[model samples]
Target: MTRHGEDIGRWLATQRRDWDRLNEEQQARLGKLGVKKAARARKAPAKAATASRQGKGGEAFQKGLEALTQYLARESRMPGRAAVQEMPDGDIRRVGVWLANQKQRRDRLHPDQLAALAHLGADWAR
Candidate 1:
């Protein structure tokens, strides 16, 4: 069962399409097997809310997933907890600037992020 799960995970992580996670060609082939993708989804793997979002595009994703997870977790949170990272270099830079501009070491966070940071104050200080 674990191996079957791994196979499914592996297949989903190397998608190449820009807007659609599984390309039209692959969907057509799968459709022949009577497993057509639901029309409700047209966005790519990056847009999907699953493990594929953590693995698509290879090593970079894994490294990023690690760093953000490490940064956001509270000591009491379990290792497998989900994390929402503030990625995109531009965004990170913007956040840094915002943080710096606020002058108060604890100010300038997005409301939700501020709440999260408060919840993990011990981790943040470290």
Candidate 2:
């Protein structure tokens, strides 16, 4: 006998467009086979808009991320929270707080933090 499992996989691919039109019994059968309906496609412009917003800080963010990554690599540890807290510049302190809160040592800086660090300049990197 043919394997119903393999047949269901093939059927799902071909029937994707007609998914909503399938009768309750057919839908239940697919459900039992662990087949899920595909998520609705997002409009391209929506993605582009978000990218533009992120792009506002992308370059600066990249610079800060590179600096932080290099610092962590060479130092094997980050500066104490107090060092950042005591920084004369508010922007630098914010960047320090952001770095302190990261769960992993290798995590990249946030876009906003990168922008702030960029404003703080090459000194922040060191």
Candidate 3:
């Protein structure tokens, strides 16, 4: 079988057993064939897939997911909501760690001050 066919064969195997059994040459063949097949599959619906993939750029993804809607009077344009939603837990904790480190740099922070600054953010060697 071509590389793509080998990949399908490997996937069809029970518990990845077939993958473990393939020689390096066979694995390469499978990869080539699998990629060709994937290309063909993607070619048929490329536009929509491209459009969506373009949206998944991590921090760049606008994810305009709104927090709320509010009424605006004729005299006043609706102002953006002032209430900030809770930041992602991971980001909140990471920022805390970064701040702690920054405060401890001896040039930035004295050795005597490190222990007190430790929990504030970045770790500075005393």
37 in model 1: Cα distance from truth in Å? Answer: 1.6
lDDT of each: 0.40, 0.50, 0.35
Per-residue lDDT of model 1, residues 20-103, tens digit only? 667788877765766644344343442343323334433433343344445445233522323333554533322223323322
User: What TM-score should be assigned to candidate 1?
Assistant: 0.22
lDDT string for model 2 (15-107, tens) is 664678788888788788787666655545644553465564555445445545554555555545443322223335333444544423211
lDDT of 3: 0.35
State the lDDT at 27 in candidate 1: 71
Error of 2 at 10 (Å): 50
Model 2 Cα displacement at 77 (Å)?
Answer: 2.3
Question: In candidate 3, what are the lDDT values of residues 93-122, reduced to their tens digit?
Answer: 222223333443233332333444333222
Model 1: lDDT of residue 100: 31
Query: How many residue pairs clash (N, CA or C atoms closer than 3 angstroms) in each of the candidate models, in the order given?
Result: 1, 0, 14
Residue pairs clashing, model 1: 21-44
| Order of models, best lDDT first | 2, 1, 3
Q: Which candidate wins on TM-score?
A: 2
Candidate 1 lDDT: 0.40
Estimate the TM-score of every prediction: 0.22, 0.27, 0.17
